[model samples]
Target: MIFLRYILLPIVPIYYLVTWLRNILYDFGIKKSVSYNFPVICVGNLSVGGTGKTPMIEYLINLLKDDYLVATLSRGYKRKTEGFQLANIDATAESIGDEPYQFYNKFKNDILVAVDANRNNGIKQLQLIDKQPDVILLDDAFQHRKVKAGFNILLTTYNNPYFKDIVLPTGNLREPRSGAKRANIIIVTKCPKDLSEAEKNSILKQVDPETNQHVFFSSISYSNSVISSEATKAVEDLEDFTLVTGIANASPLVHFLGDKGLKFEHLNFKDHHDFSKQDIIELNKRALIVTTEKDFMRLKQYESLKDKLFYLPINVVINDEVRINKLIKDFLKIKL
Candidate 1:
């Protein structure tokens, strides 16, 4: 597809101009953006997909959930459902999308997760409830200009910063690199665990954050155990298995497992890929199968794949925890 990429290079300027113009409208207030008294923290990326937004959102939830009534709103990507819908007992991966469903499942009875394509309407609905949340976390809503997030935590991968990338139809960026200026905090996701001070300074230099923006680096921290509905097993115990992945990037996971001296075959799928009946049959035939936490949320309901299906959980191991947490807290505390 390298040849196709070269062919698509010509359309890059068109895509770039369209996105740039849209941002200009949002920036200059030609388009109305709602600002709320309650804190709305947006964890999003300039690129199209998988910059560890989910883990970062979860991190913020964990940090503030105890002290604040926390709620999350997402676009509910690829779900069959439409409009504003708060997750309830009837909710499923098909209804509220995999990521939101996963959030509801994991944080049940603790946090509220809702989905809507119309973010402004979703916030209105969330705010209308009698037990209103003290803070709202907008999952993957940076580009949704209707609601101006109080704090924007923009994420990009360590390997490919947005500054070095071109717009869509050519590179993976969803918006122009100048869009990074809107972010209050910028995080370089998926850095090496042992990333050095000097290397981090180099990354910071490349990011070249504005005076108001704070840049941070983080790496993925994998759980020692793989979890299923019925049980959990140490990663080492699963020496051989089929790694079925429906994630944007699987390289970090592959390297992590390989480094642990594990033996496995990978069944790679696109990010947020939906499984078919035939796919289920094939997956059920495997002696053992492991998947991502997000993908597992979508696949777990298949009774055929239950006993063998397990998911590995991961968290973002920020380079400096104290400083980052303080920044988030301080931002939330602004005139509250």
Candidate 2:
């Protein structure tokens, strides 16, 4: 795969040029962009996937849902549906995509979750709803320049910052590193729990944020137990089992589990992999199965695995939570 990416390096410039030109058009207003009067905060990344975007969106939802009628708009990538679909009792991972469905499942009463590839249309649809949202959170729509969000939160992984990456094919970045300028807040996610201030200073130097941009570091916090439809089992009590993952990166979860001295055979799949009959049959053979919460949204739909299937929940633990929350709240106040 590494060799293949290097072999396709020549195509990288073409991809970069196209994406760069698109951003330039949006920047110069040559192409139209719909701006909202209310707060429209976007949590996205320059990379294709795996920068903890879902957790960041959930964090925003939790932060604002108490005082505001918060709503989330996702592109519903790879979903079977079309146009704007408001999540309701009948919503499934297939209908709204895994992340959005997860949001709906968790915050069904507290907030609204909707999906539309056309973000502008999604916002309009949200406005039409009986209970209009005070704030709309756009999930993974950084490159979707049709809708101009009031505040943009760009996420990059601690291991793979966008500054070190180039455009797609050769690198994971969807656009050039210069695109970071558009971000109001840039978060370095999945950092070590004990990351030193010295190292953070080094990273700050590498990032070189603009005067208006705020940089923060965050780490993933995993639940102490694995949850299934029937029961919740403590991580230490679990025996040998099957570890299944359908995400951009599973190494962090794998490492976390390994550190706990747990034993399991891994069945790693590509991000958002649609399980096949054969795959299900194989998974059914395992005595116990553990997976990520996002994957659980889709996997839980299968009746055959309900008894043994389990998932570990994860949340983003930002180093400066109070400050970040204040910044977001301040933005909302100004917009309102």
**Residue 87 lDDT, candidate 1, scale 0-100:** 94
lDDT of 1 by residue, 231-281 (tens): 999999996799999999999999999999999999999999999888898
Candidate 1: where are CA atoms >4 Å away? none
- Whole-model lDDT, candidate 1? 0.91
Per-candidate Cα RMSD to the true structure, in Å, reads 1.0, 0.8
Best-fitting candidate, measured by lDDT?
2
lDDT of 2 by residue, 293-319 (tens): 889999999999999999999999999
| TM, every model | 0.98, 0.99
User: lDDT for each of the candidates?
Assistant: 0.91, 0.95
